[model samples]
Target chain A: MSASDYESASKGASSDVATFDDEEKGLFGRFHHALHATPALVPLIVLMVAIGIFAIVLGERFFSPGTLTLILQQVQIVGILALAQSLIILTAGIDLSVGAMAVFSSVIMGQFTFRYGLPPAVAVAAGLAIGTGIGAISGWLVSKVKLPPFIVTLGMWQIVLAANYLYSQNETIRSQDIRDEAALLQFMGIRFELGGAIITMGVVTMVVMVIVLAYMLRSTAWGRHVYAVGDDPEAAELAGVNRHRTIMSVYMLAGFICGIAGWIMIGRFGSVSPSASTGVVGNIQSITAVVIGGISLFGGRGSIWGAFFGALIVGVFELGLRMAGANAQWTYLLIGALIIGAVAVDQWIRKVTA
Target chain B: MSTEPILKARNLVKRYGKVVALNRCDFDLYPGEVLAVIGDNGAGKSTLIKALSGAIQPDAGEIWLEGKPIQLPSPIEARRHGIETVYQTLAMSPALSIADNMFMGREIRKPGWRGKLLKQLDRKEMERLARDKLNDLGLMTIQNINQAVETLSGGQRQGVAVARAAAFGSKVIILDEPTAALGVKESRKVLDLIQDVRSRGIPIILISHNMPHVFEVADRIHVHRLGSRLCVIDPKSHNMSDAVAYMTGAKEPDQHLETA
Candidate 1:
């Protein structure tokens, strides 16, 4: 529009548009500014408030180290998956195959150790590679082939799920066999009592991941590129960012993280089963966490820590409701309301124009 | 005014299906001058600049930068050759802070081990440079350098975009209607900005529909017509009506200033 023949654009910047500062004068306005400054704060606050309510109602028993650590352990799998999901969603893309990829990767690790007689560590490495390879395929399709991530990952989810059953023959590597031979495969399940709380290796891994990814997103050039590509690919391209490379790496990195989750999934479940339907259920669980975490599905708007808080929020709700003798269905009802409320708040925060 | 042209385009031709966007169009930009490109809707000014900025490749043409023929297959390639373009969209990430947007692709890294091994960004230095550039452009009203671009007013955003171009556009800067999305006061600031950038000795190619703005900042006006350059008129010699008449074909130059 360098040589716009009509004076169409100048008409937009009138007195009304210039009056953006006028509206930012009250409590709601301050909240809007705070949310705009750090979107993840909303999920963090929600998680704390939920915990406070549960702690007050259930007394110190509910807030004890044992119960708190149990919450971390329960959320380990979904927390890791949501980390991967958060990266994909921040780029305005969704990875429907995330769950299938993790499950399929676990199946590969278990089968390779048994079928090929490879070292347990080697088998674990193979699983991570397969996970990353699956991500690369999805990334290639989305970044280079320009396919919509939704469709690509949806098709990938089906393909990977079917491949899991076919390749693993729906076999279940029992906990007994794994514990006997592949003690290394269950390394993430190794637990220790720290100050009367049982902390699993899987929880440690998730916390470390959240910290590293959060730092990378805030302090690295690559992280900035991810947000830029997600925010506006064309803009990033014109600004000299290799948009395709950025997106391709994001998917690959998400895949690598998912691969790690798969390894941890073994630790969490203590078994590698091709028919573990819980892995399939992980897809929706991660998305729910991300939405409630205040990460805009539109992309490039939330913190990775928000996803961690999001997963914790769900874990807290489930445990709190159960301890209060509430029905399991009540958890769903409340989470559904939170999802809607989160999106509504996101929209409100977005309306803040300085 | 008699020095060699800094940027020259010769016999450029571009077509989209049956539509001829630029037919035998020619352009020349001298150093340290604001060259205003004025034309009607279909006069091919947009296409002409796109070809020059490497947004679209002309079917047949030779773009000479500093008297050397260069091929710009992509905008990145054009930027590498020290030609920066501030597009109509401003090409900025809205969620990013002003400092991040300023140093989008060419971010500075911390010195020493952390820089080499961990690849840490020099956020402090980048923010400082960004603030300096904005300050140089008299855009210091922005309170926080860390504020996201989306929070800034439209005029302030434009100021940032222009400042970015001026800071890094070493050879030439192409501004696509920089003031079109701004109010009267904002447009006035941008006009001042164009003059300020020109004062720093970098040539600019400004395309605008505002004839008064065109006349105000322009040293030479390139009037585009029928998908090509009609003539280059001195803004000092011609008024707004004359430029409009030349562009709309109501009148033509007595003799076309075809070449620089």
Candidate 2:
């Protein structure tokens, strides 16, 4: 076979796949394609339906602006934490230390302000630095030390939890004291009325975090690298992506976000307490939001907006159930079903490898 | 043919836990030539490819690219010097869009303040380039440019992978078992793709065990036996049996055939 023969024989020989990209037929295929295109849709639809159901059942009680705005306020902290978790999860890694890291940073802020007599702003900065530095340690362990992310963050969870207890000596910083001395500590508690809903600054912060992080993940090279690294680390490496640097940077950025979550913790509770439920309930709840929101647990195949919608779904369930006079515990049972259902649907959608 | 080799390897020795995988193996790839490396399983052919592609560091070897000795300690480093490899797995991120997979590591940023200050990706430009490259291979039949790679058939995925290598691989392109898992029709497409790449004047190092495919497409075949290059035989002058015999240690290559 001469080179000229190859050219003659090769002409017009396209092995184009016949079934490629034919508009998926039938409801199942169309739904799969739809879910594939917009991962956040599942949670969004679930959220809308849950709200509609409660509005019909509870009438004016559920449809009121107070109840609706309160749901957003309640999920705001978890929403911020989910943003941090989504960053790690997108890399196919989980950060079990999110709540512990946030609470620990808040404790550090209190100590810096009261014990050291530092200004509230300076103390808050120190807290942010500590949170980021601790996250960097976890990143170093995962990237350089070659440790599994789950194990590194699991061990970090315990260590940071213990440190929070020891450092704060179980002291609670009162809201009055924060108001008199370090007013900046309670900054996110400030509220304003908007379109019939009373919106807290904390809710605004969470919304801003989601919008900004979503933009970063969608529009930047670093964002693409995150998906690549999560989708297939080995493949990403072969394509010239610095896997270590990317992983390290993700952990560090997650940590910085967790730090802000800590600052907002103070505003949400009106006090700095080591025993805040953010540390205890935050880890599981944020993960719950991420899962229900439609982000795959396996990594690299979800949207950050899915997580926000996920948190909103839980919020709707909680507020709706309470208004309907049903046990709030029913919210857990339904959410448990949603998480498993989301994963199953994700698996089904993932089979579109035609 | 030019006197200088475009890519050259000498005395590449790699040992894994007291087992010598590549024992002083030598290889040469000339400019614009299809150099097929044929060997039995465990003949160190893959180890040789890995060393050349920088997938693994050779304990001792000198790799010369266009007459300059270079150290290839990693796959990323090899790609830096215009050496692209399409692995047996195709090494693609299946969930990403076609343009995203092609520009996985090197993404073009948007222009002006949005790009310079915000570090935003210029997705439109990348999609245009990806479409152009695929079209160059006459593979523009697939309509959607943003469709995920997983949705494409096996042949189309391999086509995208090949187009990617041809687009960015400024010097050498290596394809490992490109048609191993393909049907006859798909294999024909890949064979055509190889010839097309060679027609574009880029040298290719094809690693395969299939004799017919190798003989049909390769200009020169390098036989590997006992962890080293037995000889380099010209496919134009030799037949399949002689090449297989040399590789399996049943026949010794003549001195004239060795230097071709």
Candidate 3:
């Protein structure tokens, strides 16, 4: 056999994606093939299919410009959370603290608006800064203390939950207090007509984040380092990539994304509860979307685009089920099945490629 | 022969608690030569290479790169001194593309007025360089430079790792049992590549247990028995059985053999 055959065999064993004949394609074709062949594409395509089916079922109800904008607005907060979770999962770790951290940050923002009486903009900024600080501390504990991510993040989740309750004094902050800061409240409220339908500012934030994150993963050194650390920390270190530093940055980015999600949540709901979003089940949905979108829990294998499509798929599924008169129980069953099917497909794909 | 050797380790020693790994090991590597280090499982061959590669600091010894005595703090320090190593497992991230693995931490930047703003990878240049380097060793079968290393076979992965070391301008290429995972035919192909590298004036430190392949390519052979050097011999002077006997500590060093 020739050397190319040997190289192709190695590539197949690692990626599970069949190598395309380089002779048949140039640069653009190669990149096209790369995108199509990515494991994450399966879920993304599935999401697009779900969207089409939903629009057909709901007709103008789902496809109307207003409905489309609503879908974007509704998915934006969970989408950000999913993106944050993707970063952690890509490192073969999880941050159970994300939901609690976001909730805690919201409570802190409530304090800024109600107790301290800070400007809404300042309150928002302070709330986000607190989230960032907590994230930095957690990152330090994990990387410096060499704690298992699961243990550290789990402990952090509980700690933040308790902290949120204590700060809010187990009371729901009034919507009036939060809305008084017009600038802060309008951050996610900025709406304009798009093809005769209003689109919220939340959609813009989600779109920009998706683009920036996807570009970073593809082009930047830090992005490469993230992949490297997730792949094999030992090999990455041998290559001069600092594993600790990369992991710290990943957690920080995860925290920052959670802060964005919290910001959207407060803007949309106009209130903060110590236990807000407790029964929403958005975390499970977001994680399931990520898995369906083809981001591997094994780390170093998925992209933010996958996270985007994953979120879209979840949103479409929920909207479709609701239109079909499906109860909350049936929606849960459907989501559970999708997650299982996605995981099963991922395993099958991995085995065949290996 | 024309100049001082590229890398030398004298009195190198290492121990893990009560277990000694490397014991006063002295080694010399010259340009355009393949020094085959052959031994049994517990012969301290790996320990010596690990110390030399700076994966583990020696308990007592001096490592001289280009005739300068320097302490190698880590693998990065060793690489900085122009020493590249290919471990038995290949030590490559299977998820990354071949070009990405080739450049890795040292990627070539695309030519642009703005450095970070337009800091795209010089894809054409990287591919061209990779292809040329592989072609120089007559490896033209690999068609796609974008293919991930996980897609390649054991022998192909071996070639990539070796190609990377050569491409990086390594003064000494330390390969730890490169053919340990290959089939006979594939192993022969890698052996041929080793010969090609030797022809190109790149010294190789080949660590392997296979005696026939070692004798086939190595000009000089060193045997280690129980963490210490038993004898250094020209492959032409002794056959496979003699080398094994020395490595297993079943025979004494013959005085007639040339000593370093």
Best by lDDT: 1
Expressed as tens digits, the lDDT of each residue in A1-354 for candidate 3 is 232344445443432334656666678555455553587676777877887887887787777777666777778888888888888887777777777767777777777777887777788788788777777778888888988888998788878888888878888876776566545744775677867677777778889888888877777667777887788878877766667888888898888777777777776777777778731355565677788777778887778888788888777777777876778777778778878887776666554242
Cα miss at B171, model 1 (Å)?
0.5
lDDT of 1 by residue, B140-255 (tens): 77878999998788999999999988999999999998989997777877988999999999999999998888987899999999988899999877777888888899986776
DockQ of predicted candidate 2: 0.48
User: How many clashes does each candidate structure show, in the order listed?
Assistant: 1, 0, 14
> What residue runs in model 2 are displaced by over 4 Å at the alpha carbon?
A1-24, B255-260
Scored against the true structure, residue B249 in model 3 reaches a CA lDDT of 72
Model 1 ranges off by over 4 Å:
A1-28
In the order shown, the candidates' DockQ scores are 0.44, 0.48, 0.32
lDDT of 3 by residue, B123-146 (tens): 677778888887776666676787
Compare candidates 2 and 3 on DockQ and give the better one.
2
Give one digit per residue, the lDDT tens place, for model 2 in A45-86. 888898889999899888888889999999988998999899
What order do candidates take by DockQ, descending? 2, 1, 3
Q: How well is each residue in A1-354 modelled by candidate 1, as lDDT tens digits?
A: 233334455656653322335454788778778888898999999999999999999998799999999999999988999999999999999989888888998898899999999999999999999999999999999999999999999999999999999999888999899999989999999999989799999999999999999988988999999899889989998888888888888899888888888888899899998887646888889998999999999998899988999999999999999999999999999999999999998998888653
Q: Enumerate residue pairs that collide in model 2.
A: none
